[model samples]
Target: MRAPYASDPATARGRRVPEDESSFRSCFQRDRDRIIHASAFRRLKHKTQVFVEHEGDYYRTRLTHSIEVAQVARTISGALHLNAELTEAVALAHDLGHPPFGHTGEDALEKMMAPYGGFDHNAQAIKIVTSLERHYAGFDGLNLTWETLEGIAKHNGPVTGDLPHALADYNALHDLELDTHASAEAQVAALSDDIAYNNHDLHDGLRAGLFSEDEIAALPMVGPAYAEVDRVHPGLDSYRRRHEALRRVFGVMVSDVIETSRALLDDAGATSVADIRHVGRPVIRFSDPVWAELREIRQFLFTRMYRAPSVMKIRAEVTEVVEELFVLFLGRPDLLPKHWARAVSAAGGDKLLLARMVSDYIAGMTDRFALQEHARLIGDG
Candidate 1:
């Protein structure tokens, strides 16, 4: 049974553009299906997670990371007796706005767009769903339910202060209660993202030779996991040993969130979704001990993996790719695909509008497609 605070599809606030309800699926399920089929979601197959798309077939791309996140979200939501469908929908759609080379691409775009209201992946995600997607016959975008949209926009926490332009524009049309916390399902998705990345980055870092098993084996949560695995399965091969220890580490994080959040929810006395929103703080989170340990793990990864010499070299190269592409597209709007012509014409020589149009085009590109365009347009091949 779902918790009283869980979002109910029957009570969903409905989509911006009303449509007949699905006979077999709940509204949140439909939202999940739509997100899965989106063109933006498909492009994640070639978008970077930690490594560039062509770096190796083994590294996780945005697509795989999203899938893993959804899995973790489902597990946590189910354990918490929350609405798993809504949680899964938010998890699956969370990274839809990430550009070609991951953070490197986003950083370059943010610099280029500083004058044009800045660039935020969270806000861009709202933009992509609300306006950029033009597949449906009746609407410009997927027309997801208000609940799903809220989960997507505020999954991290309440939005206050200066809102991202993309989110602001959409909020004006339909109020998303920007100053309030999102539902517990959304909170579950956010924490699931944390668990998924922390676990997988270790796996990927090991695979990339940025660090070794012994190096990580000395870390807080990681050390105990390795010791436990060795006790249970002595003389295990290196590959199996690494996998066993990491899976235990993953389990520990999941269990910690489930236990911690459950206590917080019970203590908050929240009996409805509204109570969850107005509860003044996030109920889903790792235990304080786990949070501190995770920090140590993150710091280790930040220094040893994310900022290693080889990775820094690649970051610089990809940053150049995103920067040059923005410049090229802004100056030569005519080089944009024919489908973008209408939007370009609509810009009517307004620099901000034209630059935003260019930003959308480049932000949607896959890593391979961005590289291909760079070579074709700038003769950089």
Candidate 2:
């Protein structure tokens, strides 16, 4: 049974291009299926999360990270009596807009496109679903339901101020109520992303030898988790011990969100999805104490893992790849793929339009593909 404030597919704001109802699936379920089958979604396998895609097989790529986020989203949504399908859809589609080399690539692209509209993964995601994907016979994009689009547009919270050009363009056609908070499902998806990354980055960092198990054990939530694991299972194998402790840490974060959000939801007294959106604050979040601890953990990761010397070196290398590629393509639109060439030709010497076309083409390249293209075209293999 769904809560009063949970999104119901039967009452969903319908798709932009209306279609016959599915015989078996709800509107949200259809939305989830479309997202899972999207070409952009499949490309996530070779997109970076933190480490570049070619770094290691075991490290989480964007694909695996999205899957983990979806799992956590479903768990939390179910616990809170929200729509799991919508939450899972939002989670699965959240990072579909990320460029080739994770943040490194995005940073480079944003710098290059500054004179244009600037690049934003979140807004690119909206562009991808609403206009970029061209598989449907009846529509240019997926024609996802309004609720799904709204969730994708503002899942992290309300989007205000100057919107990304992609989002701004779409919102002008169909308003996503960018100034209001998203449904409870989207809020759950956003937090699930937080949970998945916090836990997995530790595992990945340890695996990469950037940090040791003993080092993270000194952190706030992690220390208690390690102590409990040691008390219950002394002399455990190193691998098993690491896994057990991290899982416990994951549990603490998940449980905190659930318990704290429940309290917030009850206090808000939002008996409808509209009320939840207009509640003037996020109803889903960690408690103040837990958030403080998480912040400390994030700071440790920033120093010991994200901005570590080894990682920074790789970031520089990949940032150069993205920058060089952006410059090369911006100068020579004739080199773009045939389909993309047609789009560039349609730009008719408009630099901003040409740059956005280049951005879309380059942004879609996998990390390996970007490297190969750089080697092939730039003679830098």
Candidate 3:
């Protein structure tokens, strides 16, 4: 008989993953459904991947960003003969833990949560998927398929630390050899995140009139990337061209992922996407030369797009606003809505004490909800 789960060329493009005959679901489709039903996933509608609330009609929020990442991942998966379902799953749920107001909010929360567990969005993503999201499985959460969970666990595990306080510290994540040999499908999602944000941040900045296309085009890899788009769609010339330009960037990134994964799979004679990791080669991410170019692009975003005076002004205001809210809740117990005050007071611990209370309050917030609470306390709501 043919090897189990073997690819059939006929079902190649739009194949659903084989579930039991009674309940047909592909691996990626399962991921997508579980994510859609998860509380954290729904909250992404309000979280900031980049721009703040109500900034622009076209600027991407976290939900839109996740959808776009899925698109990029699926494109690569289709071309490379990898499982599209797995790619879509990875793309949809990647940013479930990001907070509002973007990095400024993340930093503010990190400072407060540091004594308990310094906040990192990647770590938080895993936490949300594994422990936090509730379901009736008596299993704590959605119990996503093992394959998807493994990728989420490794997606951005520390370059150094794998020491979850409860786990035996003996096994560092990098050394503990989990199957990080993600399908080209999964790898493309991670790379797609880089492509999506880098291009879109440029678009957002350009839209805000913070920078010009020519100026962004002068930056390292963006110069070539945007130029390729200009050439690809010669007739589209509105500032809206950024949208089409971004489409080309995704095309380039996906093409490379497909090419890299195919070469690795072909050389190893692997029977499936899961098996090609003969020696853990890096695939789907940028190759060495392009990686360095990406680093320069990241650096440019950090120095200019991120640090531009207008951006900094908004960041500062957001920081001050969140800080005041943090202080109010932690200092005067009565200021919190009665439930939180009772919840924190009943716990009676010094460790994460106030910060956990703060985290609970903040995590429960929608963008508008948080601001209204802030305004209410400040007498501005």
lDDT of 2 at 342: 70
Itemize residue pairs with steric clashes in candidate 2.
none
Error of 3 at 135 (Å): 5.3
Model 3: lDDT of residue 137: 49
Candidate 1's displacement at residue 332, Å, is: 0.8
Candidate lDDT (C-alpha), each? 0.94, 0.93, 0.63
- Residue 53 lDDT (model 3): 76
The whole-model C-alpha lDDT of candidate 3 against the native structure comes to 0.63
lDDT per residue as tens, model 1, 261-361: 99999999999999999999999999999999999999999999889999999999989988998998888898999999999999988889999999999
State how far residue 215 of model 2 sits from its true place (Å).
0.6
Clash-forming residue pairs, model 3: 17-26, 28-85
Q: What would the per-residue lDDT of candidate 3 be over residues 144-235, giving only the tens digit for each residue?
A: 66556545545432134433321212123223234445544556678778777876777777777777777767876666767777787786
Worst 10 residues of 3 by lDDT: 165-174
lDDT of 1 at 147: 91
TM-scores of all candidate predictions against the true structure:
0.99, 0.99, 0.79
TM for candidate 3 is 0.79
Model 1, global lDDT: 0.94
